[model samples]
Target: MEHQSENKDMNHEFLPMTSVANNTGDQVAPGVFVLTTKIVNVYFIQCSEDPSTYYLVDAGMPKSGDMICEWAEKWFNHPPKAILLTHGHFDHVGAVNDLAEKWQVPVFAHHEEIPYLNGQKDYPKPDPSVNGGLVTKLSPMFPNHGIDLGSRIQPLPEDGTVPGLAGWKWIHTPGHTPGHVSFFRENDRVLIAGDAFITVKQESLYQVMTQKQELNGPPKYFTTDWKLAEKSVQTLAALEPSVAATGHGIPMNGSKLKEGLPHLAQNFNELAVPDHGKYVD
Candidate 1:
């Protein structure tokens, strides 16, 4: 089936923002690979029990379809069985339509995220005035429009089981967006934290460009609900993931993940939530 958005004119344009980590790939865990295209990260997870089967965690930046395909082929020699979305932000789902169409794979997301993915609703605009740096100021240019994935998008299973993935479950970690979710494997404590929390000061153009390893909140300009964001941080921190690959920055683990995550969780308001912003109460 062809992928058609409700808004035929809806489009994602490439942003000028980038980082040193762009185009780099790393294996954060056994069979779990993280690739950064432009800025956001997309994960490739090969099932240990079945070498031939694997899944794409998130689609990367706009016009990144070919890069994602190349990376997948380089590692698995085939397309993913399904595309999993943490949220429907422009950067996260940029290559989704192209990849899904090419591979003929099903796309899954949290039920609440369906609207954003299926063209039923647009995300709230990024708050450019959030107390942040250059990236925050440039937020006005970011796309808040939703794409139309039509019938290709399905709600993630209510049982938390990830489709085609064994030993992994999705956690409803909203606040950045209504249906934002993080994938976690209880046995390994390996987490794909998505934008629930990140490893860079996303609002600062300089830090984002340098790939500084700082555990911070979701991109502030696009984050609408601080209260829910705080809760989401706590939820993931409680997981105590051994290694975390976020939407931005390189993978983090060890004492950093252990100490930093909970610290961010406890001090979310001061550390994550901007003191002043259009979305702040």
Candidate 2:
């Protein structure tokens, strides 16, 4: 799918004022909504029984709290029931505490991600030395703030089932982070792929800025284990997701996702894996 090139100013207004939906949300799938922030995408899943009860998936960067809350109010008319974290990455969970506290909702994360979320363990510092593109070069500047959400944090259900959203399952798609999980709706074959697979080659700022759509593996410099990462891609490929909305880039579906996914899963090393990087060791 081709997208027209649009320039975003320093104010970060990508869409026009009239086109911007203070409450107009993008329907990623049947009940899933996507609200793209400055850096990351925050998903809002509405509960089937009670529309007011919704789940917020992956809080964006710290600067995104107000934007997120505004969107939430416009869409759901109230705070989210819970905040489900894909992982404890600096960007993904940056505003978790802020949103959770304001809404007084509990945060759910995989057990394996506890250390990083609880501030006990730090991810390997990003290496700007990795040769990729502008995003990789500026990696060292990405904020790595750890907020204390322990008071409201809870472990994800061991069964991989997300409460309130029946018929959906969470898969352990580690390598981006130990506890990173992607939501899958088997019946509709819609996948809420986290960073396990992105539509754009995230290492390249040009691709991200342009919103180029292509199936690619996780960001290399931030990804820790190539072997595990490959397996995770293969695992998702086997599911044969009919539609996917990922952490970066626009939503993708149809023959492109069907055909390109296996190729990416098979040749991930050549397409996205860096030869040498900080996380590789």
Candidate 3:
């Protein structure tokens, strides 16, 4: 498979902002739907028996409500039952308040992330001083404030089972953020990996915008601990997920996912780990 391509004219109209309802949202698995936002992906997992009551994972950048609503109307024809957050990153939670208010649904996240989500703790701002690509250099300008969804916020289930998402379990894969988590469906062997493992070098805007697919660890410059990040990758790799849809880039599966995961798990330091960046301690 080609690693990079000049898809300059490739119509990313399917990205949430433009053709939300028109595009056939990518299917990661049997009942999993992926709605691509500006550069990140917001997932919607549907219940086989009860289509109306689905679980939405992550909210894309601010003003993403229209895109999510457009897709939900065409896909579910109703509001989601709940919202499950992987973590409280600004880009991922940007539209949480708007969507929660519109649907009147509860939002659940790990307790460790509450401080960042409740305006009590500020996430480590992106460091433009680190060198990776243009995205890193320009990331300092991105918004980093917490969105107030106090009324809808709730702590994730202590047992790790997401309330409405049956057959799925939350895995605490910290490092990118102290409280970051990932979703895994053991029955189907499908993983909704967040920033714990991105398919592209997320620090590069070009890579994210172009949807390059590579099994890389969390974006190095932003990830706080190299040791923990490696452990997280090894832990997820042990599950041997047949399919994985991450925060950035498209979904990957089968031999490609299986074969690539070990390589990433073993040599994450050399391949995706930054030499000397802001968060490396």
State which candidate has the highest lDDT: 1
Candidates sorted by lDDT, best first: 1, 3, 2
Task: Give me the runs in candidate 3 sitting further than 4 Å from their true place.
Answer: 1-24
Sort order, TM-score high to low:
1, 3, 2
What lDDT score belongs to each candidate, Candidate 1 first?
0.86, 0.77, 0.79
Query: Which digits, one per residue and each the tens of the lDDT, describe model 1 over residues 172-271?
Result: 9999999999999888788999999999899998988788788999999999998999999999999888888899887787777788899999999999
* Candidate 1 TM-score, C-alpha based: 0.92
Best of the two (1, 2) by TM-score: 1
List per-candidate RMSD values in Å.
Answer: 8.7, 6.6, 6.6
Candidate 2 worst ten-residue window by lDDT:
1-10
lDDT of 2 by residue, 119-155 (tens): 7777877777655888988887876545567778888
RMSD score of candidate 2 (Å): 6.6
Better of 2 and 3 by TM-score: 3
Query: Which has the higher lDDT value, candidate number 1 or candidate number 2?
Result: 1
* Model 2: lDDT to the true structure: 0.77
Q: Cα deviation in Å at residue 196, candidate 3?
A: 0.3
Residue 184, model 1: Cα distance from true site in angstroms: 0.2
Number of the predicted model whose TM-score against the real structure is largest: 1
